[model samples]
Target: MNRLLCGLAANPALPPELVDRLIALAATPPGPSDLPDPAGLSADYLADLLVRNLSERADLGPAQVAALAALDEDTPAQLAHSGHLGAGDVDPAVWPLAALALLDEGRGLPEWARRFAADPDPSLRQRLASCAGLPADVEDTLAADADPEVTAELAWSTTSAPVAARLARHPHAEVRQSVAGNEAVPPASLAALLTGHGLPPARSCLVCDGREIPFAHDPSFQDVDRDLPAGAGCDGTHGSTVHGTWARALSNPAAPPEAVAGFAGHPSVWLRLAVAEHPGLPAEVYARLAGDPAPRVRAAVARNPGTGPEVSRVLAADPEVDVRRAVAHHPRVPFDVLGQLTPTTRLGPHPLPPISAATPEELARGAASGNGRVRMLVAHRHDLPPELRDRLAADPDASVAKAVAPHPGLSPERLRAMVALHGQQVLARVAANPDAPGDLLAELARHEPSARRALREIASHPNATAEALLPCLADGKSRVRAAAHPALPAAVVVGLLADPDPEVVEAAAGNPSLPPAVMAQLLP
Candidate 1:
């Protein structure tokens, strides 16, 4: 009974009388004699579950909010936290707990919270500091507070440049460290810390100059070979505060050229690697780092957007595969260099930007390369000339032929020809193409001992006709996909709800053709 009520409560189209009845039932717990409680859940517990689920409904209005609020103290808090009740709808003065919960959840605060900046409770001031768009006077009061934690919280959260600058100079190390991490901290202040000028000597790590700990202990750098120049460590043991401050300052976009230049030559390879990736790096500094003994540093330089053509060409032929791969995608890499590197470069999930901008002649040259991998790269390009595409489609290599089969621009005649030549080899790719013709998809659907994987793609193809999908419903391999096809008759979709296979039933339930009335009935 509770399950049925929970389902009905979630239905947006549920009648108003049903909603009122559910709320009334929640107010009065069911007696032992009222119904069989097969689940053995207590009446009070079931009532609370129903009320909470009802509170989640977006359509709840003032009347529903009031009724739920009256059922229990927590319901009002839940209603306010759910965001269904506006400030005018629920009076915070009447339900103070609801108002406090709103503040704790980081939901919009009440206007009265403005006074919290000077509230005697430091925690309250700290919470108020985290809120956006605080009044200027309120902000000033919090920034001047005696509590370092309040100032630290403001330092980490503040967008105002002046507040960050002031906090950067705070005598307390914690507050200054927080300011160092804040994006709005002035570049000069970050530079000062990076250069160890304004930073206190007590905060400096004696063991490794704030460089060894991250490389030795940080998981992000675990793959880095410890034998590298950066890891010739005296000891990995050190306080994190000092090292963290320098790292955060170095990563800041506002980091000054002086700080960046200082870090480039730092003894720690980790520091040099960080500076190499900085987008605002000066050209001369970038060029200098390109020759860094560390391959990872060279790789970072290759990946840097500011790396110029000369540096790109240099990295293109570097001994390290990682460095070559990184420069292969660089937009500034010389065209001839990119052509030389394509055969060995593996395609990652991200498209190669440089190749996308390649000239037709360059693309043709790549298509005609002796290596199949080079031809495979050419086949992936969306702008490949038709003459070149057809020539590659007939390539002796099956993998190269498959690579070009899915190009949406492939003409229908070419798609058919590929299927006739390769048969099932290219059938799945043709079916997956968005531009695959309906007649071809229908023919593929009826092919003998059909490509099991291709049938699934054909079942969901937008161009699939009713005839194509109808046959799929009988094949267990494609039944679930067929059940979900929008082209399936509404009657057939509804009938699939009773399928023995749970997957098919779920697919049927999700089909848009299933009537809303049937959907409500099918719930639970």
Candidate 2:
């Protein structure tokens, strides 16, 4: 190689294609020359550039992806030379690449997955648990790997059936906890896991307890407030050892009530909150939590199904509406408590419309409510009868009208007439109903101009996700065009950055939907 070309290979900007061209052009190698100081290069920027550039290569293959994944521990210098090329830099470029790497890297992958799976190394195992594309068949290896971490990772995949069963019995309490807490594991499965427990929750530890130690977490589940960016924070600390404990509490719901009560005074509210809200907490525990000073703790009590009607009745009378909202939704709050929920009313700054329209009792009670939500509730309840629906149909807030639009007890004909009889606001609720009948939209067009506009907008939208209103991008409607323009496809949206309208262009450029390339073009 020409000595100069060899020196130029160190230029970060010189793409691989450029290097090859220079190498082919050079005829001779020179005396020993030092390679460029890779340390001088910005690791992050170089990593991003190389990854982006190589990821797009269509000819990229799996051997390449595996190579990059392996180079994870190598320095930047080793990486550039080992052109034994793993999927170039694209191995981590996209979720798909990671998935591809998992599949392409054969079973011979360093026994890390097995070792890490069983590893006492919390950091290694937690990272692996969150890793994409773990092999489906890895369960057997993991189950036998003997590290609580490895077995926990397998249990966390939760979807792995074979792993789930063994992990349910594995000697470690934390491993079993991961199984119990896994969303994929059904409540029934959790019931089964609870079958053999002796004490201390599911606390088995290969590293610690052989016989005397009980399987367990701190009685109160605590969230480690590692203000550090995710994946950069600490996990729970047990004994003298320190490792990542982020994914450790996988199946804690099956933990016993007494175990949870043990942590009610935990220094961290996160842990207290966890204990307060844990499904395993029996009614007495949640009721005991009813007077917790933090609103979240009290809210947890209000929400727990275990709280009996007597306790729920007392909590419903608490001043906080948040507590009240919880009461409204609570399964145990009997009708008597629900009746007490009718917040008192008397006209003030926000005068509610007259009760003249509602049937006598609801109108009287609703007219008295100081809270609009309470009044709105009275206006909506089925027990109010038909005459009341007509009276409050004129309530000033658009939200109030929409809230009343879909009473199952109200006849479809009545709902259709309300669309025409009422103004624009009812359209939002009608639109929210995926199964809304055509007659309602037709009536809306006849009665409300704003409603007609919404209908036309919905019909013309580019991307029609169930929640998507018409995207206005290149479309002519200024407000809608602004909303829709940003959500355009990357190739198309990037092209839209040069659009003449500032609103259209700005929306496309600034919109969350426009990807990086489009944003870059728009910004610069």
Candidate 3:
């Protein structure tokens, strides 16, 4: 009997009404069986299996999802784990359970987050605050939340610059301090905190638990705090740890050059070190720090963008090997001086200086250099002259070829030649290029087995045609991208709605090609 039911459920020709009846039968408990069969098949197990199979169907809509959730205590969670449930799918009665399941698994969608943000329960709102990649409006609503803890949590985890700025002035000291410590906090806010100007005054010491005693009297006081002036603390010395805030602010990449320069002469070596590492430090300050006794500070200056040729030349010959190596990597370091330094140091993947900063002569010199690293560095520049670009594309070094393959200026003919010569090595780069022609991407998509990365890139490429994306749907590695591709046909997108991979299903459901009626059914 169970086998017959399974067979009927698997039949695509079965009508919706019959499928509904099958679902009802699966949800019902079986009566006692008098005779034992040769093959053991329990009704309860069959019911669970039927529900799983039904839930995996691409055509399972809101009504069906709601019905499935009502089948058993575990069904809501099972459906939630399937990643097919949208905001409007789960019955309101089962929403709390389904939401908790989704949030616990870190799979909560934007629609759910917007709904949860307005939820009266602080616990729910607090949980939502901790989630990363929140929508902009949701972030704004949470930023203004009455609960200090919610606002504080948002401040800590948010990568949004505007959100960080708003939270930097939060009424609660805890929230403000969290914003200060946040790496994304704007430079103006950090500088204000360092100068003891932006934060509101509080009666209690934030650093030492509101202690009234002088900072000097605190047993925990380190030499670092000795130089911090009175009242520099969040409110006063009593309310915040001035040095701690200063250090965090100064270390921020956005810290203002003028504000950082203020600390260039400070007593704290830590503060001085932070100042040295700042990329926008004034040239005069860079020169001054280059002569400092501390090797680490000088080394930092050597790597700083503001370090002029004069300072770089001095640092190039420094006794400290690290300082010399830093000078070798500095973009501002003269080409002649860069050649003199040791090539043994491994080049980091850090982005080279902007292309606008390089003169044509400098770029040509880098391209003509015997070192592949120099050629590779030159290849990263987007505005390379045609001759230089072709030269780098044909370079013997595979890395150099790979680097130049993504240049938008590369003609389709050149790109095809590179792929034929370098084969799979350069396919991903060519696929990733925004200017890669649709015809080329379509051709590259044919070699899917060997070009997995290229397929993934092609799936997301604006130039990718329906032809390029069709084959990617069968590949698990690129399924998510293919499901999200704008070029994917509505029929294909609908099929992906039942993808075994939860992320792929979610991507397919979100695809723009999915009908408005279908999207309306999916939305809360």
Each model's TM-score? 0.63, 0.46, 0.53
Model 2 Cα lDDT, one tens digit per residue, 1-524: 22122223333333344433433332122223523323343334334334333333333345443433343343222332333334344322232223223433431243434544554645555556544456665456555555576567657665665556666666665576556656555444444554433323334343343423332334354424322222221122232111111122312564545645666665656666766667666666777778778878777777666667877787887777777657656654564455576553221222122222345764556634555555565555534556666555555555455666654455556566556555576764554334445444334434435544455444333333323333323235534343333333456545555555433443443344655443332211
Q: How close to the true structure is residue 218 of candidate 1, measured as C-alpha lDDT?
A: 34
- Model 1: runs farther than 4 Å from truth? 1-157, 170-182, 199-238, 265-270, 291-295, 357-432, 436-510, 515-524
Q: Best to worst by TM-score, what's the order? A: 1, 3, 2
The candidate that wins on TM-score is 1
Model 3 scores a C-alpha lDDT of 0.72
Query: Please, what are the lDDT tens digits per residue for candidate 1 over residues 57-110?
Result: 777767887898888767887887788655556555566456545655556454
Put down candidate 3 lDDT per residue, 115-154, tens digits, no spaces: 8889888877887787777889999999999877788789
The alpha-carbon deviation from the true structure for residue 460 of candidate 2, after best TM-score superposition, in angstroms, is: 7.8
Candidate 3 Cα outliers beyond 4 Å, as residue runs: 1-203, 207-240, 248-270, 278-299, 310-331, 337-342, 345-351, 354-356, 474-477, 515-524
Candidate with more favorable, higher TM-score: 2 or 3 = 3
Query: Which pairs clash in the backbone of model 3?
Result: 205-210, 205-238, 205-239, 206-239
| lDDT over C-alpha atoms for residue 159 of model 1 | 85
